[model samples]
Target: MQKSRLLMKFQSSGHTTAVLRAMSYASPSSKLKDMTSGIEFYDKITYIEEHFEEEKDVLVQKL
Candidate 1:
């Protein structure tokens, strides 16, 4: 779940796509498949925004 938030933030900020590529190489245990499922994107974002309330600077730094 945490990793998914990181990936989404990376994507939202227009990183060089390296993040997505790296995710592809991640082990199945990372739950990359669940993260990549399109249906979960918005929900995950909402969850992150509501729960983590992550600051933009922190998010960018994590990416």
Candidate 2:
């Protein structure tokens, strides 16, 4: 049991670090405007990886 808990703690910490790194490298949102119509468009932004989400879900369940 002790080993299992320790493994989980390590995995959680690693996933957290990965999430932070991914967020730091993700591109900031950018806006674009049409020259003729003067309409603005915004790009969809991604802050984290999908694998992180899955890892988090698993960690939460284990806890």
- Top candidate on lDDT is 1
TM-score of each: 0.31, 0.23
List ranges where model 2 is wrong by over 4 Å.
Answer: 1-12, 27-63
Candidate 2, residues 13-62, lDDT tens digits: the string is 76653454355445332111111111111011111133556467765776
lDDT of 1 at 36: 58
Clashing pairs in 1: none
- List candidate 1 stretches off by more than 4 Å: 1-30, 38-42, 51-54
Q: Model 1: per-residue lDDT, tens digit, 1-63?
A: 655665676577644344444554565633465355432445566666776755666777888
Task: Indicate the residue-level lDDT of 39 in model 2.
Answer: 17
Spell out the clash pairs found in candidate 2.
none
